[model samples]
Target: MSYDKDDKRTHLELIQNVVTRMASNSFAIKGWTITLVAALMALSAASGTAKLFFFIAYVPLLAFWILDGYFLSLEKIYRKIYDYVAKDKITNEEYFSLNMTLYISRYNQIENNKYSGFKHVVDACITKTIFPFYIGLTVLVSVVFTLAL
Candidate 1:
C-alpha cells in the first residue's frame, strides 16, 4: 500500500471528486423527493381524495427525509476525508481503508450529546430550502386531511 508521490496525488484528486459527487447526490435526492411529494399533492387535490393519500404521502416524506439526512451525513463524512487527506498527506493504504461509518459514529456522538435522535433528524432536515418545502406540503396535507374528514 505504499504510494509514490504521483500515486498519492492521484488518490487525493479522486477523493476530492468523491466529495463533490456526494454533495451533488444530496441535492439531487432532495429535488426528487420534493417533486414526488408535489405530484402526490396534485393528484390528491385533483381526485378529491386527499385523506386516502395522506398516509401514502407520509411514506415518501418520511423515507426521503431519512434518505436526505443519510446523504448529508455522507457528504459531511467525505468532507472530513478530504480534510484528512489534505492535512495529513494520507498514504494510499490509509486512503483505501477509509470507512464512512467512522465519521458517522463520531457525528452521532456529538449530536446525541446535545439532542435526541428525532430532534437531530428534524433539525437536519429543517435547513432553509428543505424546511420550507416540507412545511408547505404539511400544510397541504393538513388541509386535505381535514377536508377529507
Candidate 2:
C-alpha cells in the first residue's frame, strides 16, 4: 500500500472511530449493569428473593466490569496504532496489515504506552468513574441483602 498523507489521516480517523465505539460499548455495559442491579433489587425486596437475586447480581457486575476493561484496552491499543501511523513511524504496509497483537506483544517498547488487557482491568479497578460506580453498586447490593437477612 502506498502511503499518502491523506491516507494516514483517514486511517487515524477510522481508529478514533473504533475507539469511540468502544467507549460507547462501555457506557452500554454500565447501563445494563445498573438495570440488572435495579431489577434484582426490586425482586429481592418485593418477592422475598433477596438471597438469589443478590447472588446473581454479582454475575452481571463482574462480567460487564471485565468486558468494559477489555474494550478500553482495545481502544488504547488502537490509539497507539493511530499515533504511529499519523506520525509516519511505520510504512503503509505495516500500518495497513498491522497485527492487532502488535500492541500487546511489544507493549513496553512503545513510549508512554501501557495498553494491556490486564493493565486496563487494574486501571478500571482504580479509575474514579469505573471503580467507584461498580464498587458502590456491589456494596449496596451486599448491604441491602445482609440487612434483609
Candidate 3:
C-alpha cells in the first residue's frame, strides 16, 4: 500500500496526539494522587485515628502509583510508535495502524531490556520521575504515623 506524503504525515500526527494525551493523563494522575493523599492525611489527623487513616491512605497511594505507571508505559509505547511512524519504517500492512499492541512484543524482544511485559509497568514505577515522589510520600506518612503513636 503506497502512502502519499500527506497520508504519512497525518498518521504521524495521529500517533503524536496519542503520545501527548498519554503524557497529559500521567500528569493528571500524579496531581490526583497528591490531592487524595493530602486529603486522607488531613482526615486521619482530624479523626484521631491517624494510624488507621494513614494506612488507608496507602491504598490510594499505591493504586495511583500503579495507575500512573501504566499511563507512563503507554506514553512510552506511543512514543516508540511515533518514532516508527516518523521514520516511515512501518510495514505496508501496518501503515497508519494505530494499534500499539502490535509493537509491544517487538519492544519486549529487545535483548537484555528491563522494560518488557509487566516489567514495563514496574520499570515505569521506578523511573526517576516516579519513584522519588511516591517514596517520599510513603516516608512522610510513616514518620507521622510513628510520631502519632
Candidate 4:
C-alpha cells in the first residue's frame, strides 16, 4: 500500500498521545495514593485511632498500587506499538491501526509465549520505579503505626 508520509506521522502522533496519557494517569494515581495515605495517617493520629485508620489506609494504598501498575503496563504496550510503527516492523495494512490486540498478539508470537497478559501487569508492579516507592511508603507507614501503638 502506498501511504503518505504525513499520514504515518499523524498516526504515530496519535499513538504517542495514548502513551503520554497512560504515563500521566500513572503519575496522578501515585499522587493520590500518597495524599490519601498521609491524610488518613494524620486523621488517625489526631483521632487517637491509629490502628483503625492505619489499617483502612492499606486498602487505598493497595488499590492504587494495582491501578498504577495497570496504567504502567498499558504505557509499556503503547510504547511497543510506537516502536513497531516507527521501525516499520508493522505492515502497511496495520498503519493507523490503534487496535492493541493485533500488536500484542504479534509481540507474543515474536517473543515465543513470554508475554502473558496478566503477568505483564504484575511485572509492571515490581518495576524499579513502582515497587520501591509503594513498598517504601508501606514500610514507613507500618513502622510509624507500630511505634504509635
Candidate 5:
C-alpha cells in the first residue's frame, strides 16, 4: 500500500492507544499552571509589594507570564486534538503513530520521506519539561530585576 494509506492505518491505531494518556497529561499541565499562578500571587502579597498597585509585580519573578500561557495553550490544544481523534470526530489518519519502528520498516518501500511526522502529538510532554526550564530562567531574571529596583 501507499505511504499515506499506511500512515492512516498507523494513526488510527495510535489514537486508540495514546488518547487517554494525552488527556491526563493536559490536565496535569493545567493543574501546574493554576498552582504557579496562585503561588506567584501569594509571593507578591508576602513581599509587601501589594502596597503598590502592582500587587503581583513579582509575577515575572515567578513566571514569564506570556510564555507560560503559550505552553499551556499548546498543551490544551494537544489534548483537544487527542480527544477529537479518540472520538473519531477529527478522523485525520495522519495524527496517529503505531510505531516508529514500523515506519522504519516501511521507509525503504516509500518513494520519499514526506511521511516523516513531527511527533507534535507528543510535543506537549516535551514542553512539560521545557516550560519549567524557561520558567526558572525567567523567574531568576525577574528576581534580579526586582532586586535592582
Candidate 6:
C-alpha cells in the first residue's frame, strides 16, 4: 500500500484525474439528455402532442450512472484492502492481483479509481432523484406512452 516518497501532488493528481473522467462522463450523458429533451419539446410544439418516449432513453443511462456509483463505492473497499496489505492483514499476493486488475477492469475508458469518493454524492442525490426518475419514466413510457401509440 503506502508507497515511499508519496507526494501530495500525486494524490492531488489522482483526484483531479478522477474528477476529469467523471466530468467527461457527465458531459456525455447530459449532452444527450439536452439533445433529447430539445427534440421532444420541439416535437411536442409542432404536433401539439407530448410523448414520454423522450425520457425513456435516460433509463439505461441512469442505470449506468448507478452502476458507476457502485464502482466508486468499491474504491473505498479498495482502500480497506490496501490497508489490509499495508498492515499485513493480507499478503503481497492479494495486492498483486489488485494491482494487475487496475488496468484490466476499465469500462469504456472509465478507470477503476478504487479510492475516489464519487459515490457519496451519487448515493445521496442520484439515488433519490435520477434513479427514481429513470425508473418512473421508463414505466410511464412503457405502459402509458405505449398505450398512446
Which candidate achieves the best TM-score against the true structure? 4
lDDT tens digits, residue span 10-39, model 5: 655664445455445545655665566556
Positional deviation of 20 in candidate 2, in angstroms? 0.7
Question: What ranges in model 2 sit over 4 Å off?
Answer: 106-116
Q: Which stretches of candidate 5 lie over 4 Å from their true place?
A: 1-15, 48-98, 104-111, 114-149
Q: lDDT at 70 for candidate 1?
A: 61
lDDT of 3 by residue, 40-143 (tens): 88887788788888789899999999998888888888888888778766677677888987665555564344455588899999999989989998898888
Q: In model 5, which range of ten residues has the least summed lDDT?
A: 116-125
Candidate 1 lDDT? 0.67
Tens-digit lDDT track of model 2 for 30-56 = 899899888888888888677888788
lDDT of 4 by residue, 78-126 (tens): 9999998887778766878999988988878987766777899999999
Tens digits of per-residue lDDT, candidate 6, 73-141, equal 444344544444444433334433444244323321343444334545466335553566546654644
Candidate 5 or 3, higher lDDT: 3
Name model 1 segments beyond 4 Å from true.
89-92, 101-123, 126-136, 143-149
Model 1 TM-score on a 0 to 1 scale: 0.68
Identify the runs in model 4 with alpha carbons over 4 angstroms from their true place. none
Error of 1 at 121 (Å): 6.5
Model 5, global lDDT: 0.47
Residue-wise C-alpha lDDT for candidate 1, range 1-149, written one tens digit per residue: 56666766775687777778867886887788778877887888788677767778888877877777666655556776666666664544465545655544654575574324455555667777467766786787777677766
Highest lDDT scorer: 4
Count: clashes, candidate 4:
0
- Give the TM-score comparing model 3 with the true structure, all chains together: 0.89
Candidate 6 collision pairs: 75-114
Compute the lDDT of residue 127 as modeled in candidate 5: 69
